[model samples]
Target chain A: MAHSTTLEPTATPATYTDAPRTGTWDGGNEPFKASYGKLMMWFFLLSDAFTFGAFLTAYGMIRHKHGVFTGTAKQFYFSTAHWPIPEKVFNAFPGLHGDLPLAFVALMTMILIFSSVTMVLAVEAGHRMDKADVQKWLLWTILFGSMFLSSQAWEWSHFIGGHEEGTRMADGTLMFGANLAMNQYGPPLFGDLFFFITGFHGTHVFSGVCLLVWCFIATTNGTFEKRGHYEMVEKIGLYWHFVDLVWVFVFTFFYLV
Target chain B: MSAHAAEAEHAYVPGEIAKPNTAWIWKTFWVLVAITALEFVIAFTLTSPDWRTFRNSIFIVLTILKAFFIVGEFMHLKHEVKSLIWTVLVPTSLLIWLVVALVTEGSFIGEVLSHMFT
Candidate 1:
């Protein structure tokens, strides 16, 4: 090969701006200072929030229409009106025969909140580079998350199974437990909304647990240690906390209000 | 990796706890519990139809407060940069508006339709 003594660069000069080495679209050096992973997670949560908001809003709209009417379609405007009391509907609790309004869900709420605390602790330990503490707290978190899911399952079964004896309608037709098309609960929309909203939230919890378990296994295998950061834990913590946060709203919209 | 390089790369002091005291976490937990308990009490004791609207408003307010705690503290959004906080919080506020608009408009439509049909 013959070597040329004079060097000539023929390529056009690449244009440059103040943009980051990584494309601005990729969120490099953004003011938020959050990693791409974290930023994307936030975006996802934001969209998910809208999904939930839309569902709840639709429920509220339908409920407002049907919830207040008591009489048949002919004299609907002249009928006495009341929404089905949520506390009354969800009164049953495990290991108790009598009515205990909101107690079961209350316990479920506490369990979820406690799990959030564990998640925070796990993130804290991650920051401290304490592998064992992260493992332990993550384990507790997984336990609590599992407990929440199981309780939700039990609640769903109980709700679907219908504990309330058939309520007699004006035409003397009997209504049983909740179904998409019908429900003993005041309005058909109520059961439908309950199943849809809670089921959606339950799916999030389920996925959150799966993510937690993934983190737990990776932590046990020292993946984070090698990476020299526990950002994974923090990222997962955001998701877990988000799930808990959504439940707070659900608890209020469905159970309390 | 060399010890010095490893230390520099990690940038965390091993065995040193981050936010060592967990009192804040516990405090938030108690606040959540208290709010939930109060919600229960109100649900059971406030039976009058006149209070239904007011009770619902209270439930919403309390729920928002609890949500603030969970997102602000547990998720550590409160401690994040001002821009990041706003980035999240501003959009979320729009959701509340979305709910309000949809509910109010939907209810009004329902009321008009029901009355018109009747």
Candidate 2:
């Protein structure tokens, strides 16, 4: 429709009807209609982008309305008025913990960042048609992705475990939502939003790990190598990079903002 | 019938780097990293009631810049013809606009809530 209904053929596209439906987005054409995989991947990314945008926007709206102080956020467990700050809450250590700063989450962030790097490396390996390199980088990317997922698991546990000073409702009454408001560390909305946004993202990461693992497994068994190129790597790379990109926004909005 | 079905109409080369310029990749990476760092620094250093507005404006600009490089270089949005570029950017821009409108409505509710309940 785009070409037929339109007058000019701006870019030349090559058709490979014989190729397997291996991707929704990946390398198909150097400049024309990308492979079905890459196209689909972009569609997925676009939908995902909207989902994330919606969440962050809602979070912002809530923050603007309820960001003010109802009372001195008091720490119930620690016996202090300093309730759990977002940075402080996420920063603490697990075992040898002593008022650390963004320890676990920071580690998780690094893991994700490394995974992003590994993903690019894998894509590069794909470009070279180096199966060994593709396998190596992709495996590293998968492992790091798994590690990030685990770290997120730990973060969730800590959040659900409940903090000292919890959430204060609109009535100025402090109530526990089963560690609902005053979680194991700080405010309830912190956990509420943390779980809602990051949890959803964590699900995506988990799924991505599964996808990466599948791709890596295929790499070992000589799938992409058999096909004679690394478009697979780039296809998944796009998704991986998109995930990393989304996290940057989530971190900025939920943490720093 | 689908645009994709006209695949025979367009020639394709798989995994071929459009620019074939490694130099641009490295240069773009450095520029992107530098801009990201600057964004972080400005986010931390600024302090004003207009801080929210200023920070938001800067963050958005930085985000758009970063997105451009990623799309242009990494995702190869630039390699495609101008029509393709316009097709993608127009839709994505419209999506962002939709989100912005929804969020503004949410903020309005927040304002009303603050007045009634606060």
Candidate 3:
């Protein structure tokens, strides 16, 4: 059947069995030529962005109301303030613990960003149809992603376990360690939001790593080679970069601010 | 002959698959590293509470800058069709506006609570 150039539908006789292609939205050809998988991925990421934004916005509201701990070492030991400073709350390293504020988190951020670079390289290699290069870069990306996950696990353990003892309240109760109900750090909400936001981001990183593994396996086995397209690598690269983008905002609002 | 038949008869040559140059990737990586280092320097060096608001603004700006690079270059969103780009960016922007409104109302509620309790 002949296809019409315009998108409008045409009038036809009732007896006609085969209708002409109208180039309308009913057809499978997308104006963007975006694959169904990639377009759906974009929509999914958009909704996920709203979820994270709502969480962070709620965090901002609570933080603004309660205020943060502004006491120093001198006041911290003597004063009875409940809120704790963020840097003080997250100052411990894995081995060394001499007030290395923001050091560990900064390292984790670098590792995640570097993994993003490797993902970009993988997509570029896929563009060139270099299967070996794509495999190598994907491996590197997975390694860095796993390293970042491990770093987060260590940080969570250190926080939940507590290093040195925190301040004792006047009620003869020791205020140490963090949980959903209570936290040694500033407010209880502070710990709750930290776990929620960072945990969610970590889960994304884990998922991205899994996707990379699949892509790597597919590349090595010549699946994309047979299809003669490397767009899968590009699609996964978009998700990986989006993960890194969200972390940028999380680090800014949660840690730096 | 029909157009489809003519097109099918042509050689199945692949698109340009020349050796990829990776200089641009490293350039973006170094840019991100430099911005992060600057953030750390600002974080540790500026200890005075007097500069708290100023420092916080710096952090936000730097964070957005990093996001631009990651989304634009790494994800190749900048190279996509304008309509496709808008499809992803415009809706997400409404979420940002929601954040501003919610936080403002939240702080106002805090003020009301404090007035009643104090």
Note the DockQ of each predicted structure: 0.42, 0.16, 0.41
Error of 3 at A52 (Å): 1.1
**Which has the higher DockQ value, candidate number 1 or candidate number 2?**
1
Tens digit per residue, CA lDDT, model 2, A1-257: 44576576566445744565455466433454577687778778888887887787767655554543333223223212222334445555667546554556556656776687677767765665667778888889889998888778777776665344555654566544334444444434555777789988988898888889889888888887678766777888888877877776776666554
**Which residue pairs show collisions in model 1?**
none
Candidate 3, residue A95: lDDT? 84
RMSD of 2: 10.6
TM-score of each: 0.85, 0.71, 0.86
Q: What are the runs in model 3 whose C-alpha is more than 4 Å off?
A: A1-29, A70-83, B1-17
What range of 10 consecutive residues in model 3 chain B has the weakest lDDT sum? B1-10
Measured with C-alpha atoms, the lDDT of residue A41 in candidate 3 is: 79
Q: Which stretches of candidate 1 lie over 4 Å from their true place?
A: A1-28, A69-82, B1-10, B14-19
lDDT of candidate 1 at residue A180, scale 0 to 100: 87
Error of 2 at A134 (Å): 0.5
The TM-score that candidate 2 achieves is 0.71
lDDT of each residue in A166-188, candidate 1, tens digit only: 66555568766778877676666
